[model samples]
Target: MSVVQAMDLGLTFPAGDGDVVALKDVNLTIGKGEFVSFIGPSGCGKTTFLRAIADLEKPTSGTLSVNGQTPEEARRARAYGYVFQAAALYPWRTIEKNVALPLEIMGYGQAQQHERVRATLELVNLTGFEKKYPWQLSGGMQQRASIARALSFDADLLLMDEPFGALDEIVRDHLNSELLKLWDRTGKTICFVTHSIPEAVYLSTRIVVMSPRPGRVTDVIESTLPRERPLDIRETPEFLEIAARVRDGLRAGHSYEEEHV
Candidate 1:
């Protein structure tokens, strides 16, 4: 079923001189338990669109519904989990405490909070580091902890914005695999924003490609690869073909901007 839906969604920011159009006429529907990615150039509205869906930003026009309710309703109901580009952990809090913060704020009992934190830490492969500080972990480990914090709340939808962007290539690969396993286990709907074409293709069931300067979706590609995706899939000809298609979509969008100029 459609867990997230955006209809003719548009966003505009108030600049000093004029309004900056970040997104225009974007429409998308994400299914329950689906993994979707938004990819484009730096100035594209990938992150902006994500924020709109998360109720962190309000669109200037159109409608957005999460799980058949408004973004505000979903957000207030804590229907989704959000992982930002940075780890955003509290330095003073231990890893377990950081994960439990949400639960505590949401009024979960101490016992329930402890159970959820432990389960989520294990889910992200950080089971033993519950007592460690955020500074005590590597960049990748810190990101995993951040993800654990997001998952600790057990929200149905996950909105991730470049959560692995700062990690090294090898670390990113490892986390990508771990993320797929987590998705399989949790079955939550994930909306991720990134600039990496291969990363988008590997991690997403659907890719929403957008353009800059008035970030609008130019293409939506549904991946046909198997659910059991492996690192070796990147070397396959089919993978290359899909990557090329994504690149072409971005290029076409850029060319359209140039033509308009």
Candidate 2:
């Protein structure tokens, strides 16, 4: 089953000058268990599209559905989990308590919450740091805890908005590998947004490249690399080839914008 489907979807924000188009003519389908990445220049509506999927923003036109339901319905049903760019953990909450927040809100019994929290923290390799506060953990570990919070409810679709973008290269590389392993183990569908071409090429089963403003998908490149990608794969010829195509797609978008504007 398709995890997400969008058809001619468009969104525009109200502005005093004029209506600003954020996304235009975006049509795509994400199948179950696929890791799809959206890579484009900043202000390209990658996060906007993700927000629309999460029901944080209403579209101005066209249609979008998550797990065969409207975004509103899907959101109310808790159909997916979202991880943001920052590890937005509450500083006062311990790692395990942060992970358990959702379950508590859902009124899960204390026992179930404990079990889920324990399992998710372990999944993110944070088993030994359950009592640590967010400020006490390193940036990478804090982000892992954020991921655990997202996964605490076991939602089948994960919407991640550049969750590792702020980390140092070494830490980001490590988290990228860990994320892939988590995806493999959970078989959850992921929609990721990133600005880095190398990160998109390395992590995605398919990469969707969008244009500048009024974001439209310019290209959707299917990765030829194997699922079990190591950190060194980024240096391989095949990987570089895919990254080049993504770069070309970005350039094409800029060119189109320049000519038309």
Candidate 3:
């Protein structure tokens, strides 16, 4: 099943004197169980497109469907889980409690909430730290907890916006590995946005490259590497080839604008 479908999707923001186009002529399809990453420069509509999927932003033109329904309809059905760049955890709540917050709001009973929290925490390898607070955990651990919370409801679609961009290199690498394992085990459709070519190439089944302002997809590169990727894979020739293609796509986008001007 196609989890997300967009056809000539466009979004424009009305500025003081004119309008700013965030996304334009974006046509894409994300299938079930696929890990798709959006990569682009600043002002490119990577996150904007993501937010449109979440119904956080409405498109001004074209058609978009999530699981065969409108984005707002999909959102109302709780069809996806979103993880922001920051952990965004409540320092006052215990790890388990934080994971259960969504369930609680959804009217899940106490027993069911506890069960879901325990299982989700285990999925993120945070089983022993259930009682700890966010500040008590390391940055990486806290992000893991945040992911656990997102997974608590067992949503089939996971939307992550540079969830590891803030972490240190070593921590980001570790979390990236863990995230792939988590995705493999869960088989959730993931739509991630990132600026790092290596990160996009390492994690995605397909990478979407976009232009600058008035963002439009310039290329969609399907990954040739095996799904079971290790950190060492980044150093391989095939990996570097894909990275070079992504870099070239970004440069092409820039050159397109330069030629037009």
1-261, model 1: which lDDT tens digit per residue? 699999999999999999899999999999998999999998889999999988999999999999999999999999999999999999999999999999999999989999999999989989889999999999999999999989998999999999999999999999999999899888889999999999999998999999998989999999988889989999999888889999999999989889989
lDDT (C-alpha) at residue 183 in model 2: 98
Once superposed on the true structure, which residue ranges of model 3 sit more than 4 Å away at CA?
Answer: none
What order do candidates take by lDDT, descending? 2, 3, 1
Clashes of each: 0, 0, 0
State the TM-score for model 2.
Answer: 0.98
lDDT of 1 at 91: 99
For candidate 3, what is the lDDT?
0.94
Model 2 regions more than 4 Å off: none
- For residues 23-129, could you state the per-residue lDDT of candidate 3 as single tens digits? 99999999999999999998899999999999999999999999999999999999999999999998889999999988988889988998999899998889999
Number of the top candidate by lDDT?
2
The TM-score of predicted model 3 comes to: 0.97
- Residue-level lDDT of model 2, residues 86-137, one tens digit each, is 9999998999999999999988999999999999999999999999999999
TM-scores vs. true structure, each candidate: 0.98, 0.98, 0.97
lDDT for residue 208 in candidate 2, whole number 0-100: 99
Error of 1 at 113 (Å): 0.8
lDDT of 1 at 13: 98
